[model samples]
Target: KPNSELKLQIFIDTSSLEIFINDGEAVFTERFYFDNAPQVWLTAKAQCLTQVYRLDGQAITFE
Candidate 1:
């Protein structure tokens, strides 16, 4: 991305992931299931800022 900031969002729920880039300009959907992957890595060619968040699903119990 040149002359513009790049934005990305990742949502992980039940062994599935939905990724968004540049507010839906580009997106990637993937499903991965492994009890142990040991090492996970990311490579970025461009200089950027990254953030990670863990999602909580239906934390509140309903009666």
Candidate 2:
């Protein structure tokens, strides 16, 4: 489908990347390691709206 709306979800962590397209209609995953922090960029031919969300996690120590 061309020139149609699509829902994309991308989850990125320290060592992994996950992408879900169209509410799980398609998916992609990869593992990567970098010596320094990575940069992200977005580009599109047509105008669109974008949203970003940040998630936090709690840590536990083992006895």
Candidate 3:
């Protein structure tokens, strides 16, 4: 689908990173060891929508 939409989800924890694309149609996971909060960057070839979320305990906020 050329004009179809995509859903992306990301989760970051103590030593892990998880990414889900298109409702879990594709997934990427990695283990990271960081002394502090890690920096993440996402890029796309064409115009796309992006959102960032911060989760604390059970609350999620847009940042």
Candidate with maximal lDDT: 3
Lowest summed lDDT window (length 10), candidate 1: 33-42
Better of 1 and 3 by lDDT: 3
Residue by residue across 1-63, what tens digits does model 3's lDDT show? Answer: 566777889989888999999989999999987899877787876788878887767657899
Q: Select the stronger candidate by TM-score from 1 and 2.
A: 2
Candidate 2 per-residue C-alpha lDDT over 3-46 given as tens digits, one digit per residue, 9 for 90 to 100 = 99878888887788888999999999999776686666778878
lDDT score at residue 45, model 3, on the 0-100 scale: 66
Q: Predictions ranked by lDDT, top down?
A: 3, 2, 1
TM-scores of the candidates in the order shown: 0.55, 0.81, 0.67
* Whole-model Cα lDDT of every candidate shown, in order: 0.71, 0.83, 0.85
Question: What is candidate 1's local distance difference test score?
Answer: 0.71
| Preferred candidate (lDDT higher): 2 or 3 | 3
In TM-score terms, candidate 2 sits at 0.81
lDDT of 1 at 50: 68
- lDDT, residue 43, model 3: 82
lDDT of 3 at 3: 67
> For model 2, what is the error of residue 11's alpha carbon versus the real structure, in angstroms, after optimal superposition?
0.7
Among these predictions, the greatest TM-score belongs to 2
* C-alpha RMSD of candidate 2: 1.5
